[model samples]
Target: MARRGQYAKGAAKRAEILAVALDVVAELGTRKASNREIAARVGLTQPGLMHYFSTREELFLEVLRARDERDHERFHSPQRGFQSFLDVIAHNASVPGLVRLYVEYSAEATLEGHPARAFFEERFVWVRALMTEAVRHDQAVELMGPDVDIPYVVDLVIAAADGLQVQWLLDPSIDMADRLARLWQGVRETSWPAVAT
Candidate 1:
């Protein structure tokens, strides 16, 4: 019983650390949110905080994961179709720091053996599935045509969204959400050739 209580406390502390780290990253941007700073805010020494996470990369990756969880709760709904995605894009505009963190971390995670590589790979698969479902939902309700190539549409949407994030980081004036919405609109309105089996 005592061991179980200690495990519960450890899990709770880890969660609190992740939550604080998320707020720090969201407010300071990844470049500014150092491990020391995050540790200070969480009332732990840097090494003490390291006890909760295996590595610096793991902690930062957990911050991104926490952000995803919040975004999923706030913006995603299977029945909402593409509009839910747009909502997330719009919301991202308000949190440029988190967007910057995502862009940088995702790029770094592309390298072999990077701690975040598996997380990003799984995340992309999950995102693709979610977007595919949204596209199919739209087609069922006539928002998009039945002729639409689901795989192509899903890939294109993901590419555009990821590209727009980089462009938006470079130029704050660029309306990422608006541009993505327009792209999605064009995609839905156009008749796509059926894919060969």
Candidate 2:
């Protein structure tokens, strides 16, 4: 095993490469992104780059994981509900390339033996659990009625978020954040009776 210092250095180098690779991929679509190009930007030869990532797909998946980590840290908070999710959707609007990469890989990972399959699977499971918790939180706070079906509401929220990304990708004019907020208002109004004076 490598010494602690060596391991830390290796990890730092990996992060550097990932950062450069993300930018390179953002500039040139993923389809056109080459390992050699990434290596050149990061001051490494193609073979040196391969030492860090055994395959192109491996490197791409690492980028996806890196992006997810960044997003989680940036948007995640104790608050969990429709409005919190709206902020996330609005944040996503600023990173179009990363959004495209995620959407594409998620669809491709559905195929057997894909490298990103496990990542996408775990992501979906985690998101569902988070959404369920959010719904429960809303109920506890009376923001959402306890009588509402939590599972169904969670499913709808996840489905709407994922579907909105696809639609927004196809048409930049789509206001995903606003649409979701409106949906939330509708859900709230229909799920709970209005307070009477």
Candidate 3:
């Protein structure tokens, strides 16, 4: 937490620095991005970068936090719909470079004592739980078929999304968004109840 005097300005600068770090990571990839390079790219001095993110760890953590923020925003948007899910997939695919960083970091975060250990754990938990709830909501509204197992189906959806991201990162030629939509259509069709005799 920040002190009162440091609230607005300091936090805003910190967020700005983090935003610049995202671009740096996207452009240079995670392993090659350094504080000096990030600072120079963002029009900040090295010390200025340090002022916002005291260490490389802090900058990296901010990147992880940004993922959570992006998901939360998309989930909460008033205009959210099935199209939003497609949009999220398409949007991420458009920035294939950043998606690659996410895939690499997610893989490394599973290691013992990794700095992002708790972050990734909490992130997966929240996202999976959120997807389950989304399924429930869609079900009650008749948007999702009640015959489908909500929890299990949610797990499948989220897992497939993550798995597709991994493959897409490895080979951009793969039509991940098309694959996801096809998967969605198949599942949605499963939800449609059998016609009465």
Candidate number with greatest TM-score? 1
The TM-scores of all predictions, comma-separated, are 0.93, 0.86, 0.81
lDDT agreement of model 1 with the native: 0.88
List the global CA lDDT of all models: 0.88, 0.81, 0.74
- Candidate 3: clashing pairs of residues: none
Leading candidate by lDDT: 1
What is the TM-score of candidate 2? 0.86
- Best-first order by TM-score: 1, 2, 3
Stretches off by above 4 angstroms in model 2 are 193-197
How does residue 174 of candidate 1 score in lDDT? 92
Q: Write the per-residue lDDT of candidate 1 for residues 105-143, one digit (tens) a residue.
A: 999999999888999999999899999998889888887
Candidate 2 structure quality by residue, lDDT tens digits, 65-184: 887677677777647655666777898787777678888988899999887899999988888887776667777888778677767777787788888999998998999999988877
Error of 2 at 147 (Å): 2.1
Q: Kindly list the per-residue Cα lDDT of model 3 for residues 1-197, writing each as its tens digit.
A: 45776788777877777777777776777777888888887788999888877778668877868855865686454234445566667777666656776677778899999987888888778766666666666667777788887667767877788899988777888887788777767877788788899
Cα RMSD of predicted structure 3: 3.1
Give the candidate order by descending lDDT. 1, 2, 3
